[model samples]
Target: MKFKNLLLSWKYPSILLLGIGISNFGAWVYFIALNLIVLDLTNSALAVAGLYIVKPIAALFTNVWAGSVIDRINKRNLMVALDLFRAVFIALLPLTSSIWVIYSVVFVINMAGAMFGTTSRSYITKLIPIEQRKRFNSLRSLIDSGAFLVGPAIAGILFLIGTPILAIYINAVALFLSGIITLFMPNLEKDRSLEQSDSSLSWKIIKQDWAIVLNFSRQYSYIMFMHFLFSCMMVMATAIDSQEAAFAKAVLFLTDTDYGFLVSIAGAGIIVGALVNTMIVSKIQISFLIGLGSLFVSVGYIIYSFSSSFSIAALGFFIIAFSLAFANTGYQTFYQNNIPVEIMGRVGSVFGLLEACLIIITTTIVGVSAQFISIQFVVITGSIIMFALTILLFILSMKPSKSRYYSVKSVEAKDL
Candidate 1:
């Protein structure tokens, strides 16, 4: 489906995209402010490092069944509620002077995020026509990339004009706006598998659904393995990011302002890549996109890991961020295509839980090890791990996205 068709569709994916883009901008602003607030409150790099662990830690507990809940509820409604919840949480941040309180709030917010993410994906899979999904995903990536590109600059300006507290409340307001916009999104929760009965919260019902998802995952071993590799790559990327402020300040000798500039550079790179994807690019096989994108991403990280100058580091960031556009778009399309809408939530939660566990462990080890080793060295090591895994993933992605999800019916009809 063309962009024109999407705009012309009554569902109005564009409006949903706009809401997400606004929310994402707010998220980036909140993220920057949160780290700064933590740094000010504790004056310890470790404390800031610990803040990175909050999301995964929350996911560890909540993800076990959040998908079940999401699948049962009206996903669009849930997104609006989650947005409001986060808005309230961010609004409360200024009221607390304690880092612990901040941490607790962040934890709750992350739980909301995890649910919102999973539910949104499942909903999108249903809402958009299959033919249009790739374009939709690309557009979504482009908007998200745009947010990253400008979000830091926005945050920096916010900080200059006022305080971190002010930035937080602004983000809260953005969330509320996001929620209001989401209210316009059409609800598409067709799966009554878990909802038809009153047993959505029942332990037995959830356990039975979990077993089905687990069995399905086991049957699709390659998909699960690939997802695991993606999770590892994600963990590594974030592990490196956890120490990024230190890398900027200590190694590159940058101030907070400079660091924001650096981040914006990465965002700009992604925007360029996304633009290329949405505009000039023709349809490419998902496997090829994933494979080539992974290799490029690895190379980018390698350059970033060993950078000695700000310019070199920015170039590295550019490469990584640019390559991510292709890699993530391919993976997301493949995922949405393959997963059955009914089971998408349950199956996704299992992976979400596992990914969270991996992220926590990866971030925890990196955070603690940095205390003993130089932050640069720790980051370099994580990059090395990421490079290796991406190479492996690139090899795996050469295989076609599962045929069963797409063309099997074509060949099957011929058999008849």
Candidate 2:
């Protein structure tokens, strides 16, 4: 089907796609601009890392309640409110010169985002037909990748034209526009018959559903463990990129524009990977694809650690971006396929919580490690660990029970 025609035929799905795409574009712009602002203000790597750390930490604490709220509330309204809240927060960011205020605002923005994100994923399952999930996810990834490809570059240009503060204002306006679009989009009513009739909002639902959650948790334990390992590797590996940018500036005597161009090229790699996933991944066993992707990512990081030249480093970044695209797409599809639609929000939120916790812990560890050891050593060690986990995940994915769940054929044929 033609992409535009596909979207037109699927109205709610189309709205979700557009709203998320626009919002993500704004968010990425804010993210890069905020980091630059922080760095300029503090001139300290630790301060910048701390700003990055706040969101995940906040999500770790608030995700459970957010999940519960998503389960009980109107998903569309929740997302609109969250978007508006984020817009206000972004608008306020430039007004504050205090580091602590920035940290607090970042935490709040992320907390709101976690809530919206869980609901959004669940809503997508409800809105999009099951047979079209692979395509839907591919489209989502493309939008996200496209945003990443353009947002930072735009932010950089805006910063050059005016200031980081002006970029922040633009982000706020974009977010506001996204929220307004969401408000007009069709509201997807939940399957009330599938849920309890009780008006009481207690922890009882979670308590009763604990067994099911535990069962699924046990079944996917290896995937969860691998996620933790991958999270650690990502935290360390990403830190290396930040350090490398500084090193490149100092050693290679590269201009800021050169660094920006290289970063945009890496983003372009992500766009390529997303396009590939959209076109080809539906034909493969998702488990095998995820394992292969992880292996590639680990190899990329390992090579990156040893790279001496800018071209070599850029190649490594390209591979990492490519692998991450496939791996993340495979993993998200696996979750949506396996989990029941009714409990999808809660399940996704729980997973998000776990992911946030792992990221926070890993980022802290890596940030500290960077202070002592070389970024190269950290990247190399993290890559080894990630490689080991990928191997373990591959073995686990081959098991009969796990293999069934991760198979693209099974996912397409089976109902959630």
Candidate 3:
């Protein structure tokens, strides 16, 4: 009876989780499969690298205006539409042999993805109550970790049986299924009324939204700082990660097989940590999860930065991956709790634009510096900067006066 009641309470959230898991699993499969297809078509490593650039480029173009649309529409319907849109584009990917056409299609798909990301964050905040967000995020983390491991394995099996094209079709099917699953979730905006006189987007409206976000930041400086600091940490992480293959080969003297094994170890770490996180999330403070978890993640990078062997690098991977679940869950819950749902889309998109720009700049600098200097030196410098940023975040998170931000108590969005 207790189990039945619990399941009934979580019916919608559970359904949403299923959709997210399916899409996430499909995403990984599509990523690996597409990379292989591109490599096979072009036979150039640089061409394979171009696929990675398409998403951020799409983000740079889309995020500027995505939040405006996301905030105005019915989120559930938009998500379903976006999923189907992506599915169609992904299905079309196999037919195109030209690299430019493929990049164009992928760019459109990523633009939909970026809008979907901001829409879902705002939608989740509205659909889930404040009290349940941490638990939901933890479970979501576990599902993401599972996909991280299983998705690639599934793609590999598909390759053995068929081809990369087959894997692409499978992802299309998964996304279609995800969209269908999302149709069952309740629409949060069914009873809500839009307060605007003109709903159509324009340069003026976007500028207004930007001003609103800036005003919110001014009013809630601490909250915005947390967001900015976390983004900087992620940018640094991405910069360091761009040189990971070079670091493994040049500094650690790891072969391809060893590097693959090390990645699996990190996946294992994520699963283990997420499992533990799901079990104990209710007992731990959100501040600790964000501050300490992130700090430990940086420590893991620091360990990897200084390591000279494959085993040591593997250890660093495990530690960082393990800590990521807690950090992500904590920050997600905190953001949902503290940010008013009304402006969440605008805030997320504007900040996301900055984060994307920083990633491009930081990654370019790291890559260029590694070419000029040493990979280890660039990686070590990036990691140390990340570590310092996290320490500041830790100190900020621990302030007694700011404890209200981390509380799990229910508060209305209007009150925020």
| lDDT of all predictions | 0.81, 0.73, 0.91
What lDDT score goes with residue 32 in model 3? 98
For model 1, how does the per-residue alpha-carbon lDDT over 214-241 read when each residue is reduced to its tens digit? 8777776776677678778887888788
Give the TM-scores of the predictions, in the order they appear: 0.88, 0.84, 0.97
User: Tens digits of per-residue lDDT for model 2 on 99-143?
Assistant: 999999888888888787787887776676656776777778899
How far residue 57's Cα lies from its native spot in candidate 1, in Å, is: 1.0
- CA RMSD, predictions in order: 3.8, 4.0, 1.8
Name model 3 segments beyond 4 Å from true.
Answer: 191-198, 409-416
Roughly what TM-score does model 3 have, to 2 decimal places?
0.97
Give the least accurate 10-residue stretch of model 1, judged by summed lDDT.
Answer: 407-416
lDDT of 3 by residue, 1-416 (tens): 99998888799999999999999999999999999999999999999988877878888999898887777778888888899999999999999999999999999999999989999999999899788899999999999999999999999999999999999999999999999999999978875333332368999899988898898899889999998999899899988999999999999998899988988999999999999999999999999999999999999999999998888898999999999999999899989988888888889999999998999999999999999999999999999999999999999999999999999663345554
Q: Report the poorest 10 consecutive residues by lDDT, candidate 3.
A: 190-199
Error of 3 at 405 (Å): 0.3
Structure candidate 2, residue pairs in collision:
none
- What does candidate 2 score on TM? 0.84
Pick by lDDT: which candidate is best?
Answer: 3
